[model samples]
Target: MEFGNDCKLIVGVDYGTTSTGVSYALTGSSQCNEVISIQKWPPNCPGLKVPSLVACAGSPGRSLWGFEVRPGMKSFAWTKLLLDPTFNCDSFKVEIREVAGALGILKLPEDRDAEEVVTEFLRHVHQHVCGELKRFLFDTMSPGRVPIEFWMTFPATWSEAVQSKLKRAASEAGFGDKVFTVSEPEAAALAVFRISKDFELNVGDGVLICDCGGGTVDVTSCFITDMNERGVPYFEQLTEETGSNCGGINVDCNLYRLLVTKLGEDFKNLSTTMVGPGSNFMKEFEYIKRDFNGELPYTLTLLGPVPREITLSPGDLRGIFDPVLDRILSLILSQIKRLMQSLERVLSTSKIIFVDGFAGSPYLQIQLKSALRQQMAEVGVLVAPTPERMVACGATVKGLQGIVAQHTNAVDIMA
Candidate 1:
């Protein structure tokens, strides 16, 4: 309804390891309403879950990132895989180097590898947001001065060093010096709480927020106490937990490995087999991996020394993912255990958990919910009302607060 300037615009970028999301909102006197939200996976996507990939194909030094890279998988782009610190797969390493060279950022150190890729992606997003803002506002007003600010979120478990690196990279990515960082779960919680004001959670009320994102599980417990003069609510942290390495990607990897192992038996005699003989193996693998409903089929044909049909029954495929799903469930339970342990030391009360993230994985969600019910018998855990939109919306609200208050103090930061 209302925006900051009706002209001045702010951007929120959730630059995730496995995927990236961008949300734009206007801040003004009435209310800041979200304009658009984009969540992309590796390579570029037109809709939700664009691939976080980068590659190069044309010249030896040419490069590609986001949706531009997916078509040429064998090219120099190694977007999602390169983000992992321990990604030592030889082929992946070679591809990453090629990608880096193509992007003109190969001068970076070996250990500081993925950071550069991420930086470029952030820069790309920055350009996109700026262009969008210009297109939307340039014609309407005689562009005098537009104060542009960017808000990027990271996992709470990110070390101070990582957070610092992200901030510096965001600045380098063309956001200038106006880029700010917030913990992902906190931002989401702020969004959910602001809209659900009638819930009226108290300071003593123990609430757990679980963010089930693509690359991480961010969980935090907080107590909401009051609202600032700007009308944004305040919260105090109680217990925080994260599984930085676990997410939908791991599950995808598991499914890929399973299809390879199960279907490997059919190709044992074949030579020069690439994840099976199909050019579409990688594409199909990506699809099957993220099919949250678990109603998809995995089928492939191999040809070489022996030509045969390889297919997995839904039940057989489910068997492959069972262990991976169980591990995630265990982690969620472990977080609950930690939350209870912390709460016991402080006070005695009923616990309520808020689960969020891109946890549309039917298999994963069922496993997590069952585990949550069993582990915290006395506590209540409900998925946040708008799990997918929580973080982006919350960041917008917090950004508006900062604008209206005209104060950058910590006390006023999320208040």
Candidate 2:
């Protein structure tokens, strides 16, 4: 009897709130080092941070998907928002066809199933990626090469049941039959270990990674060490943590709100508070907060029944955003407290490493550094890179791991 040789093609996808990134690794590559940018600015999609926003359109037989959604203050029902209690999914049905409820699909009919909405979204993303892979491979190989397998990643805390649902959605969307699942943290760890292999990490050395993305706060504490003294890194999970749906997106929301309120002060008798699509005032305020850079005399325009505009100085924006800033600060401090408590119980050390999108903000980074310095004086807290592309980059590393592991196994069996 003869068996087909094992083959490998790994794809690392980061399904973020605002955007989604997909990267692939060949069988023998040292790393999945390339960053694939799916969405860019101008005519921005509904998704903000990245391009995970799925716009459902086209005929009944076939549908279209992409970063084609119009920008501005339009409301978007992100799939991640489903986990938020503020959203009412009780009236919704989760149909398997689209991966989201019919009621929530951007422009679809109102009665669609939730599952259809989600599945359709996932299917589109998969198709887009496959197209990219085809183009990438065309340049590297002849047309007759066998297709590559994919390694789809999910959050570490996702239940197997939820994961099964995602896999089913992908399969239904025509993702090749050969696909696998992985956790986001594991991928992130792989990426960190790959870059810092020379750190001489030991069981006693704790590495804390914080993924401050658009919609969620994902934190992990790991005991990174060379399980085999030969320098191959192994990770031991320590206390992992998250926060109450806090992140850069939330900060944007707060900035938008403040800006709206500041503009309203110009109106008389008639109230000038924002009242559309959640807290309008808060959303505008959040945007202004994010845009504040000590620059003077910035103008903000409000679109509503009575359109209005207001000019603001750096001081004016800061004063209006103070409340929101305080809230975020408190939230960050709380998360740190939780991490410290968890560390005390899980390991004998307290060192923490912070990485993610928020790490890029000078204001946020400075505030965090100062707070951590004051609270966890003995514990080292450091943020790598300002933009916090670690998760996407790390996911790529994991994709490479998937490739290497397969090649190693095949070689062992052949010998």
TM-score of each: 0.72, 0.68
For model 2, what is the alpha-carbon lDDT of residue 224?
Answer: 64
RMSD of 1: 7.3
Q: Estimate, for each residue in 55-110, the C-alpha lDDT of model 1 and write its tens digit.
A: 53343224455666533254322243344444444433443342233222223234
Give the per-residue lDDT digits (tens) of candidate 2, residues 1-415: 1212333445666665554556565443332344443333324343213444444454322544334433322223456444323334422222112322211222323545444655666676766666656665555444434335555656554657767766666666666554467666555566666555444456567676656565555566677645656565677775554433455555544443454365443322222234322234434544554445545556655555677666767666555434434554565565556656765455533455555555455555555666666865766666564234556556666655534433211111211
Q: What's the lDDT for all of these models?
A: 0.55, 0.51
Model 1, position 370: C-alpha lDDT score? 68
